[model samples]
Every structure is written in C-alpha cells, then in structure tokens.
Target: MCNTVKVSPRKLDPETRAALVDIAAKLLAEHGAEALSTRKIAAEAGTSTMAVYTHFGSMSGLVREMVHEGFARLERQFAKVRRTDDPVADMAVLGYAYRQNAKANSHLYAVMFGGQSLAGFSLTEEDRQYGRYTLLTVIDCATRCIEAGRFRQGDPRPIAHEMWIATHGVVNLELGGYLIDPANADRCYDGMLSSLLVGAGDEQRAVTASMAASKRRRRREVEVDPEPAEAVATRR
Candidate 1:
C-alpha cells in the first residue's frame, strides 16, 4: 500500500504578483535578460522564490507575462488617444502613443521586441499575433485616412506596417543611445513620421499640420495630467 499527499497550488495575490512583475521588468531593462533569475527577482521583490512559483508557475511564465504587460501598456496609451476629425492627426497620435509606451516601459519593451531573450523561452506564432493585435488601432486610423482620401485608396495594413517599421527604427535607435541629443532625436522622429505620411499619399502641408495637431494634443494631455513622480524619477 502506498500513501500519497497532494499539494494544491498557492492562490495568487494580485498586489504581490504585480510587484514581482514590475521588479522583473525593471531588472530586465537595467541589466538585460541575463540578469533575470527567479532567485534574483524574489530577492529584489523582497519575497521568497516560492512566491514566484505561486504567482507565475515558473520563470518562463513570468517572462511571458512581462510581454503581455508591455502590450497592455501600449493598449492603454492607445485608448487614451482621443479620436479627432482628422484621421491623419489621429494616426500621428497613435505613433506618438507607441513611442511613449515604449519609452515608459523600456524594460518590458526590450523583452517584447526581442532586444533580449529569456532562456528556454520562445514566443509562439500566437504570441506574436497577440503582440501585433495592438497595431489594429493604428490600422483602424489608417483605414479612416484612406476613406477620407488623406491616404491612397488601398489596403491600410501595409501603410500601418510601414509606419510601425519606421517608428520602431527611430525608437530602437533612441533607446540604443544612437540619438543622444534630445533635440536631434525629436527632429529625427518627427521628420521620419512626416515623411511616412507624405509617402502614404498625404500632402506635405497636410502632414505637417496633422503632426502639429498631434503634438498639441499630447502637450495638452501632459498638462492636464502630468507624469507621476516615480515615472519622472525613472526617466531621469
């Protein structure tokens, strides 16, 4: 005869889980994926290694959740972009939102974009699509631009994709310290976005006007609700 005792999984504590995820993301951003270890995350989070397992099952699960968190943040930023009559302006705002999300969550951003890879973890095709799901908002804005004749009459996916590629290139460079000068980086980013809009069949003057409008809207948002102290400290 054999006797067996079964142990149930620990219930997740949302606050503790969130804290651990945040600590993991910060460590990843500051020290790279190589620094991600269950022991280290537990230590930095002031919890036990068992907490990590309790919340995420494994380190890979934590990494996967980090990727989801990155996209979730971007989605929130997109949701904050108020829709305006000018679809072109809205598209530009989406681009700005994308950049802001990446900057604000650089730790998760790096992992989300494959800047670093977790050991024994690989994103499946479904996981990749989940990430791309965030771009649907941009595509919707692009579609509106096309309907309004602001962009060429064609499928909007490619236009949205090109915008994403160009924006990603600029952001990636900025993150890599290639665009060190703030003024230069801003110029480069704005110029690149403007060029993409123009190439997408919008008039140069209209593109400039749309981008200006987007900037103003972003400024208003910041004025209305300033960045938090913690975020400011992190940015600094």
Candidate 2:
C-alpha cells in the first residue's frame, strides 16, 4: 500500500485541483489509509483518472499534497489561539485542537505522521516548510508557557515534543478503538493535558466532572425498567 502509484495532477485548473484535493481528504477521513487511491479518488470526484495524474503527478504526489494540506490546517487551528495571553491556557487549548484535528482526519493523520512512506519518495521542501510551520507553532506556545513560568524552565522544543506525544497517545488510543467511553473523553483529555502543564488545576475539575457523569450514566442504566419475559423471548 505504500508503493508509488504513478499518476498526475499538474494541468487541472486551480479550482478543480483544489476540489480534488478536498475530495481526497474527505475520502481519507471516512475510510482509513487504504482508501487513498487515484482510481478511487477520481471516481468519487467525477473526474477521469487522467485528471488526477495531470494535477498531482502520482499517488506519491497526491499523498504529499495531503500532507502539506494537513499541516496547513494544523497551522490555522493554532493561529486562532496565538493571541491568548495566558500561556498555560493557550497550551491546553492547543492540545484540545490537536486532538480534535487528529480524530477528525484520522486517515491523513495516519498517512502523514503514521511513519509509513512510499518507496523512492521523500518529503519535499514544501512539505518540510509546512511541517516546520506546525512545529514552530507548537514551540511558540510552549516557549510562551516557559517564559511566563507556567512551565518548567528548559528547552521548549523537547517540552513541546513531550506534550505532543502525550496528547497523541490519547487520540491514537481512541482511533485504535481502546477509548470507548465518549463521556470519558474530557477526563482523558484533561488527564493527559495536566501532565504537560506545570501547575494547572482545571485538570482535576474535568476529571471529577467526567467521572461523576459516567457514574450517573451507569447507575441510570442499572435503574432503568426491564422488559418482561415475553418481550425478552420475542427479542431473542
């Protein structure tokens, strides 16, 4: 599945090319990494196979575009919180956004950062530029937290990497089907975020709230009325 599949996307109009890229992203989000096929994308986009080839050059090229676009979206999400004066809060918000984006774009998330790559293709200058922008955004937030004494005094890059790993663990677990309780998402999110923040108290609040809610839900189910033997037999 990681082998290079030759195609092209160099000649399509800018609008059509953009549309095709979006269509590909949607398909990737709905399906897993295996859904990113030029033939399949062309069919879904109502265009010929040649169009994909003309615009993107190959499946490798298409994947590169997806990687670039994915990082761009990440950059935009971070940009929204760039002006927040509270570094600790900003970092937590960034963690939330990061998880939301990863869960929402699992396919692209898997392809770009999932550590698998196509043969003979490496990330290009443009790809690195987009990736650098993402890293810089993370570093910027972490650096601010460090500067404000909201985080430990150390190199912000490693701190940022650590935070990313912790946050990704949550998203990856959920994606891998290990995190089943939707009500526990807030608890899990806050628990992960608290490990990164130096002295945050909101984590306790979120955890307590989620745990209480989960308990109430379980108790409600236990207390619910049951069906009669005849109804049970009918269902069976």
Per residue, candidate 1 scores C-alpha lDDT tens digits across 109-150 of 888865556866778787687579988998999999999999
Q: What is the alpha-carbon lDDT for the whole of candidate 1?
A: 0.79
- TM-score winner: 1
Q: Candidate 1, which segments miss by more than 4 Å at Cα?
A: 1-13, 222-236
Please give, for residues 90-121, the per-residue lDDT of candidate 2 as tens digits.
Answer: 66667667766676656567656636564234
Clashing pairs in 1: none
Candidate 1, residue 23: the lDDT equals: 82
